[model samples]
Target: MWRCKMVDLLIRILPVSAWKDRLIQWHVPGCAACSEKLAAREEAMSVLVQERELVSVKDFWPVVNRRLRSGVEREAPPSRPAWQWVSVAAGLAVVILTSLWLNRAPFEEASADLTQKLQIDYIRIGDEPARAYVFQPKGVNMTLVWIEKDGEGE
Candidate 1:
């Protein structure tokens, strides 16, 4: 299968040399697959040659040059009106100013009373027999909790 694929690729990409012709002559006759592939490739190449013959080489360059010359004469796109741009800029400025005014004080200052910030009414214990101890060490703004099951000894 790989050999068949390699021959297909070589048929298209290989240069038109005597070595390629000799290879096809020697190998294609022995393999029906190779012979079929060669016939198909030759038929395709002949079709391509026929299509190529329809386009005269002498006329190709002049047609391309004429198109390029006409392309240069095409008008440029019209510019957008100045007032539309000014109104768009004004609208964006109004949106930015409104957002800034609304978010001027995003966060309010904390209350002076510390009790209002950290309030604890009461702690509830579950049905399991356990002891809970809460500690707020001095000089630190944090609290620590410790729980001990009734049956466990430390």
Candidate 2:
């Protein structure tokens, strides 16, 4: 019984060359179980081959062409919306305006608070009206003297 089971397993797994071995041939002829196993394996293989669908060369190109056309249509570029274009234009305008505003000098009174911080004195030297001021902070050795030439309105 053990030998019959082993022969059945070998018949299921062994290649054609192994099946043609003299020992397998002698065992398979007398053993009804192994012969039935071999017949069943052959029948199952035949049924599977018959049931499998094979693609013909004549129908292959038309199926491939249809798939390729569908893929190309799916990959076609979409149109942009009006709001998208408007938003892009608005963003570009904002960037340009911000850059221009950042580069421009600020408009403010020049000497609005300088007169209160520093002591102003006017003196005429030899015919020229000049304004002079000394900026010396407490406990500092550096003294800054600012003299304006031809003081007209400042």
Top model by TM-score, which number?
A: 2
Task: Please list all clashing residue pairs in model 2, or write none if there are none.
Answer: none
Alpha-carbon lDDT, every model = 0.67, 0.68
Per-residue lDDT of candidate 1, residues 16-121 (tens digit): 8776777677667888776764457667787675655666556677888897788966776655786788889999999999987886544222222342356444
Q: Give me the displacement of residue 35 in model 1, in angstroms.
A: 2.1
Candidate 1 TM-score over all chains jointly: 0.23
Off by over 4 Å in 1: 38-154
Positional deviation of residue 107's Cα in model 2 after best superposition, in angstroms? 73
Output the worst ten-in-a-row residue range by lDDT, candidate 2. 106-115
Off by over 4 Å in 2: 6-20, 51-154
Question: For candidate 2, what is the TM-score?
Answer: 0.23
lDDT of 2 by residue, 1-154 (tens): 8998776577677778655485587797788776765657667777784434655436588888898878965665545686788889999999999987775543212232343365555666667987787776554434588766665566
> For model 1, which pairs clash?
none
C-alpha RMSD of each candidate structure in angstroms: 15.7, 28.7
